[model samples]
Target: MKKVAFIFPGQGSQKIGMGKDFFENSDIAKDMISKASERLGINFEKLLFEENDKIGQTEYTQPAILLVSSIANAIFKETSNIKPEFVLGHSLGEFSALVSAGAIDYLDALELVHKRGKFMNDACAGSGAGMMALVGLDDEKVETLCKEQREKGLKVWPANYNMDGQLVLAGLKADLESLIDTFKEAGAKRAIVLDMSVASHCELLQSAVENLRPYLEEFLIDSFEVDVISNVTAKAYNTKEEAIDLLSEQLINPVKYKHSIASKDEDVDAFIEFGNGIVLKGLNRKITKKPTLNVSDMTSLKKTIEALNE
Candidate 1:
């Protein structure tokens, strides 16, 4: 079997018709979506398939994304014999990774992340929370600039190390907006504050870390059936003990995504992203030379299986 890593996408990947192909074609997908809606007391069919505003809300967005990604992974597993060398996910996607690895059940993950998103939203509510994407700046430069801003009592901090010259920042909205010109002047080709209400993966989320821990404890299994690389440390973890700590800390730590992929690139012949979009696949193109295949729907799923089989 060809060695590969399975990856999942996080927030910013959700859309109106993410899992429709699976829902329309596969009974398995239909059942999973139905169960998720019942478990969460939210109509996932409307949230995932129809046009609505709640789908973008973080609490709803979390479970919806997980459900679709889980369905995609589940359907792929049914048809493909290839197993991953390891698994990893970005931000909210980490819980989906846990579900795929058998460290947590998919229903439990949906509930956990729904609460996780609520906690995150609650933690940052009214804090003027926001995020920014900075392109064309190196890590050290961005870190130094953020440190300088923080020394002046600003709330900005590096939030995501997506790839070389692409870093994201999280903090108060005004603070991030204030730095746009500063970042641009400092060699960032583009620096724009995202229209986000939650400041993720930074000290702004400290309260969320504690709020999310109990759920992690309650939902996670004893150990992983397949090792998952952590977004916090960019390292492999298997047991619930490690998962609890890393996953909680993940709330307040910048995702080391570029590091995680680059460090493990050679171990896998390719990557298969199970989700609604090619977001991670796009990132992998810049992070590693290894090809990334995605199973977002029936068409892509078949294509990915064929590619792997070849």
Candidate 2:
């Protein structure tokens, strides 16, 4: 069997109708969604299947994405016996990874991330929190510039180390906006401020870190069935104690996505992404030469099973 690592996508991958195919076709998916709706007291069928604005709200977005990702993984597992070498997720996707690793129950994870989103929203509310995407600039240069800005009392910090030439910065909206031209002049092909109210993966979220800890303790199991890569360290960990520490710290630390994939790519022959979109797959193309397949819907699910079986 081909050794594979399972990856999940974070916040930006959500859409209006993700996982509808699974819900419609698989009894397991339907039951999972129904149970999540009952567990959270929010109608997930309406939240996920029908068009609505709540899906975009941070509190709702986190769980919705996780539910769909979890459902995809569940349905895929029903068909394929191939176990992953490890599991990893980006940002909010880490909770999804934990669910896949059997470190947390999916129902508990749904509630955990829902509260996590609320904590993050409360932390950043009215704080002018925001993020910026930089392309074509070297990591060292971006880090240096952000450090200089911080020394000057700006809140800017590198948030997501997505790939070699791409990085995301989180800080006060005004601070990130003010540095756009600076990054552009420093050889960045593009430095655009994202339309985000939550400055994730930065000290701006320090408050959310503590707020999320108790829930992490309540939801996570003692150990993982499969090792999960940490976004904070780009290393693998399995115990719930480590998960609580790292996941809490993750709220205030930049995601080491590129480093995680590049450092561990050789351990797996390929990657299978179980989620709504191919967001991480796109990044893997640049981070490592290993093939990245996705299982988002029934068609892709069958295709991925077939490919992996061969």
Candidate 3:
């Protein structure tokens, strides 16, 4: 039997008018957006469709992306006969996966992610921490370079171990700048810091994790009904407690995404990225070399289901 998996996108994938199609066409999608707006105390529809740059702000972006992805997933579940054998999410996308897997309620996940974005944004507001993408460099070399940079008082570390040759680093601005020269000298194809505000997946975000812990604990998590891969440990979480703790720790740890997808059972036939953008699809192809599809709108969803049926 060919198994299927659903993967959710993270912060960087959010764009204005992301889920407008579903919102206008499906009542289920509209209700989800409305509930998210009430729970988050903001107009999600306006922020998502009307505002051009406002939604990109971390506080709004995190929860907005989650809400859209979850709504899209719900639409698929309600409309299709296909069910995933497992679910995975990238970085902040992990919360969406957990919600879809029945480990946490959608309202809880939405509220938690809103707070998470705020905590992260505030934690690095004035500290000058940020992230960088290093292309064409092996993970081992990146790890070694981070170690060397940290010793030089720059406080840089690997944030996202994305693939065999692509890695993202996070740390103080000065440290990242210093490493750029070293990476280039070491024959790296390109090393550039992302324009993001927070240095996620690094110890620098420990303050954010501390602030988010209490909020996470308040949410009631039930036993997981489906396997949800964790970004922190890169493994499937079996229990509710493990899921909660892993999510809390995810803020302060490297997103071991390469390991998470790699460890999935070999029986998985296809990986469906259930939201905007093809970032996860590209990453999955690099990691597993399997067929992948991106379900962003009705057209893509229909095409994916049709292909699966064939």
For all the candidates, what are their Cα RMSDs to the real structure? 0.7, 0.7, 1.3
Pick by lDDT: 1 or 3, better one: 1
lDDT, candidate 1, equals 0.93
Cα shift from native, residue 258, model 1 (Å): 0.6
Model 3, position 104, has a per-residue lDDT of 77
Q: Give the clashing residue pairs of candidate 2, or none.
A: none
- Candidate 2 vs candidate 3: the lDDT winner is 2
Model 2: lDDT equals 0.94
Model 2 sits at a Cα RMSD from the real structure of 0.7
Candidate 3 Cα RMSD (Å): 1.3
**Residue runs of model 1 more than 4 Å from their true location after superposition:** none
| Candidate 2 minimal-lDDT segment of 10 residues | 216-225
Predicted structure 2, TM vs. truth: 0.99
**Model 2, backbone clash pairs (residues 3+ apart or across chains), number:** 0
Q: Write the per-residue lDDT of candidate 1 for residues 1-310, one digit (tens) a residue.
A: 6899999999999999999999999999999998988898999998888899998889999999999999999999999888899999988888889999999999999999999999999999989999999999999999999999999999998988888999889999999888888998999999988978999999988998889899888889986789999998899999999999999999999999999999899899999999999999999889999999999999999999999889
- What stretches of model 2 exceed 4 Å from their correct place? none
Q: What ranking emerges by lDDT with the best candidate at the front?
A: 2, 1, 3
